[model samples]
Target: MFINYVKGLLIGSANIIPGVSGGTLALMLGIYHKIVYSSANLIRLKKVKEDTIFLTMLSLGILTSVTILAKIFKSYILDGSTRETYLNMLFIGLTTGIIFKLKQEIKTRNNNNNNSKKITKYFLFLIGFFTTLSLLLLRTYNISLDISEYQNKKSIKYHIVIATSGIIGGCAMILPGISGSLILLSIGTYKEIINIISQLNIIPCTIFGISTIIGTGITILIIEKTINKHFAKFLYLSIGLILGSILQMLFTITKLNVKPTLTLKISSGILFITGIYINRILESTKK
Candidate 1:
């Protein structure tokens, strides 16, 4: 239970980071399946006792982190353009590490039908590649649709918007390399959602939170079962998605033109090496 809470806290915090995914962290920590399966069975309260316990702990951690960290995220970390640049660089390293790790996983797995596996891999690779390319383009296209502003005008309308964002975020949370915060940002609710949480606006938060829980649970449940049944295909697609996102994020980060100071360059180098070291440590720990 304590372990699950720790895992959730790590993943929760990761999810809030602009370019990171809680699901990606969960996968790195070797708890993705457990977390997703538990979420699927969370509300049942009948036969799945262990899943319930783990999910309860995990939920507590995620909720606690969101309520507290969202404020810090909005106020300090992402407050300025300068800071956002440095942060994005850090996330680029994180995403790079994820791609490396996923690639390692794919290499370690042996599929009996090599040709079929290769074809499926190529198909999924294109899907992930094109999806990522489209999102990268959308960032600059900037056709402003501020759904949250509409919600603020009418009390009843707010519920509908929050619910819709929750459903989207919930599903995005499970997708490899896709950031829920980025999805919210693209939708123009990133600031509004954070502000609503920071203000302790209970009704809207509660409604969104519950809806997210339900949607996330169902989405992860289906994903968990499907991945378990088709490990090779899922692994290939996830790896491709991670690879594509890392490429896109690198492009985005480099274009920001935040010239790294000598100190910043040294720090980034340290972080990159540290990321590799951490992966090795995790691998040995599992051994």
Candidate 2:
């Protein structure tokens, strides 16, 4: 149980940091498979006693770690535009590193009987999820959240946006190559989410928690089966997903009040490369 708590701390912390992968962190901890299987069966009321205990401890650690980190980030880390720019560049580099990791994995899994059946299944997934995807993109072109609007009780549209963010976050939490925090950043809700958690805003947290659970339950089965039966297609899908998310992250930040100073350019170049290198090393490593 103590170890579970520790695992949760690490994984949950990873979940918040841009470019880090909680699922990959879980994989490194050698707990990914069990967590997945247990989560799946737990929903079915199988091993309720054991799984609940395990998940409860893990969840607590995750919650504790994230809350603490959120507070720290809110208080000290993300203070200035220049600092934010540097951090974002590093994150972008790290996130880009996942593409290399995926490149290798996709090539490795390419030997699997590749065919169009898997493509068709994914087509259906796309069709079924068309509306949800639409909701996510609604803010893609303009990624900032206007809290003032929500305060007026006229932020139903933004409310819907946050709710959709929860769903995407939930699904990303379970997937390996893609992480929930990264997706949230791409969708323009990362900082708002951190602030919300730090401030203990009940409404958004509730919406996020509920949607995360729902998204996990809804997508896990489909995702598991797809990976099992169509490994190559899943890799391709993952690549596309990461690519799109990264593009969005960069795009949204461009809309921010960024000043392209010399220091900014140099830091951006160096840190971005450093992030990619660090990510590549970590992603290639195993326990």
Candidate 3:
């Protein structure tokens, strides 16, 4: 139970990072399968006691971590500084290590498969890579909107927009490489959601939260069914997306143009190596 909480905390922190995916972190932590299966079976009450306890602890951990980290990151660390650059580097390394871990899993699964199926996995990986790369490139040019202005308007249209954004963002969260916050950013609601969360604005936050839950539930069900039918293909595609997401994070950091002093460079290197080491440890423990 304590281990589950820790995994959830790590996943929540990863989710709050702009280019990191909670789902990917869950994969790295060896809880992805459990999460997806539990979510899919949540309503059926199968193994209800066990699933409830596990999911409840995990949810609490994620909620706590996200709320705390979001405030800290938004207030200080996201200021396009050397700190931000180093953080991105660390996460990139972490994500890269996850990709390697996933590759080994795929290789083991495919050991007895025919060459044609193996080739298909590689092709799907490339396809997934380019698909995510294209989406991230498109997101770079999204126009910023003044979300604060809509806060005062109690119009139904505004509520609908917020609800829709929440649904989309929730679905994005389940996708391996995509960040839910990035989806909100693309739709110009990222700031608005943050403000609502910070202000403890009950009405809007409730609406958004409900939508997110519904969206996530539906997405998880679909993904669970797909994985059951096509594990290798799905895994390969997920790996590709994870790799592409790391590339996207690096591109974004480069665009920030943070000049690295020697000390900063050395620190960043250490963090990167630490990230990889941590991931390797997690993978080994799962084995």
Error in Å for residue 86 of model 2: 2.3
Clashing pairs in 2: none
* Model 2 spans with C-alpha error above 4 angstroms: 1-34, 46-54, 75-80, 112-137, 143-168, 175-196, 201-208, 283-287
Candidate 3 lDDT, 1-287, residue by residue in tens = 98888888888887777778888888878888899898877856678888888999998888778777877888888778887888888888788898888788887886557888889988989987887677676667765555666655488877887899879878888888877776676667877777677676788878988898888888998899989999989998998888888887887687778886898889888988988998999888877
Q: Give me the runs in candidate 1 sitting further than 4 Å from their true place.
A: 43-47, 148-154, 251-257
Best by the lDDT measure: 3
The RMSD of every model to the true structure, in order and in angstroms, is: 2.4, 5.2, 1.9
* Residue 281's lDDT in candidate 1: 69
Q: Is candidate 2 or 3 superior in TM-score? A: 3
Candidate 1's error at 241, in angstroms? 1.8
lDDT of 2: 0.69
Q: Quantify all predictions' global Cα lDDT against the true fold.
A: 0.71, 0.69, 0.82
Tens digits of per-residue lDDT for model 1, 1-287:
68778777877877776557777777777777777666666655544877777777987888888888888888887654446555655556666667777777777885466787689777987786666556666666864456736745347777888888788788778788777776676676667778888788888788778877766877887787777787767776777666666665566556566676897677766665665566556657766
| TM-scores for the candidates | 0.89, 0.68, 0.93
Q: Which portions of model 3 show Cα errors greater than 4 Å?
A: 112-116, 143-153
